[model samples]
Target: MHRLAPLVFPAAGTRHTATVIFAHGLGDSGHGWAAFVENWRRRQRLDEVKFVLPHAPEIPITVNMGYKMPGWYDIAALGLSAGQLRENEDEAGLLESREYFQKLVQQEIDSGISADRIVLGGYSQGGAVALFTGLTSLVKLAGIVGMSTYLPLSLKLESTYIPKPASANVNAQTPIIMCHGTADPVLPYQLASMSRDHLVKLGYPVEWKEYAGMPHTVLPEELDDVEDFLRKVLPPSADGKTEL
Candidate 1:
């Protein structure tokens, strides 16, 4: 299994009830999301939530001129060819990435947070991984937050990997939030809609949000929405009224 170096952020308070595993976009490390948590701490004064960011191993993206960068998969082309951009499916790297992610989750569980109290989220390619891991895992988590990412080919609703809605082992009812920018050039906004439709068909409760006139990047309002969703899905306190 591939090893990942993760940055962990423990809640400022004495007790932590929730954990947010943050994954970064393509070519970015887990440290990329550090600023978001820093800002969150200052603004909300939330000290009871833990954050973990894991870095993806360096890999080559065929579509990006075979440049070696931090990528979850290799895209062979810039155009929309079906199999051209999906060379990562046959590679062992993605499976390794999944194992690395699983280890990260286990590390969190070892730290005292229950698996049910964990929320997984990410941006772009990282978001795709988070969604893939959250849904396919046997463990049911608190929620999943996918920002500017499309569902992975492995879990493509049209493929043979259809998830059983009535299965007692799967968390078919897990809440998922997908946020996309209408003008995102990297991953088209339509993919987000398709993902939402697919999840709904699979009986997963998903919240889809499109930011009009936004680009292929995270906006302040988008982060706010993520924060709010996290708070609602993973309440920091038992009373559920804790600010931030």
Candidate 2:
């Protein structure tokens, strides 16, 4: 398997206290979201958090008339409605992405960052991959942030993996942050809501938020929400506060 190179952002301090691997959406590369994180770091002041943005391999997408583009996996088709007869789910591509994603997480672990201090996040299709990988991860992660995306390969995953039921301390170890727009046309707002409901049923501790009349993209408000999520999931500072 070919390993994708990443755009690495080192922590500002002498040592990194946490590591975050955030993937990009279809047709996008690591450079796309680099600005978002730079803005986020500037606003949130998380100098102790190292960021990694991995470039998705360019592949022919069957749904887009087989045109090649940078994507976590090949999109078979778009699912605007849950009742659609055909869902373009690239199972093989999803599995391939999962393997690469695990390797990225492993690299962080080998670099001295504990599994619990590592976060996996993505937007759109990338978010779907992150959601799939994080849930099935052997090494528990600090958290997962998914925006404008839904759970991918849910049916196949259900057939293969049975998640643990949420107990007394459901999200005590690993939590989730999911946000979507109600007016999204590409992925559909209702579709994201359905995904959120499904995750809850599967015993995932998800903090789901909805934006009214928003489209299929991230907004300033959404970034603010993610910033708050980072503070909660990332490790605390020396003064016992999650300041950054």
Worst 10 residues of 1 by lDDT: 78-87
Query: Across residues 8-42, which tens digit of lDDT does each residue of candidate 2 receive?
Result: 99875555778889998998888989888988777
C-alpha lDDT score of every prediction, in listed order: 0.75, 0.81
Question: Which pairs clash inside model 2?
Answer: 77-88
Candidate 1 runs further than 4 Å off: 1-4, 79-91, 154-165, 239-244
Candidate 2 residues lying further than 4 Å off, grouped into runs, are: 1-3, 83-86, 162-173, 237-244
Model 2 worst lDDT run, 10 consecutive residues = 164-173
Report the number of the highest-lDDT candidate: 2
lDDT for model 2, on a 0 to 1 scale? 0.81
RMSD of 1: 3.5
After the best TM-score superposition of candidate 1, give how far the Cα of residue 65 lies from its true spot, in angstroms. Answer: 2.0
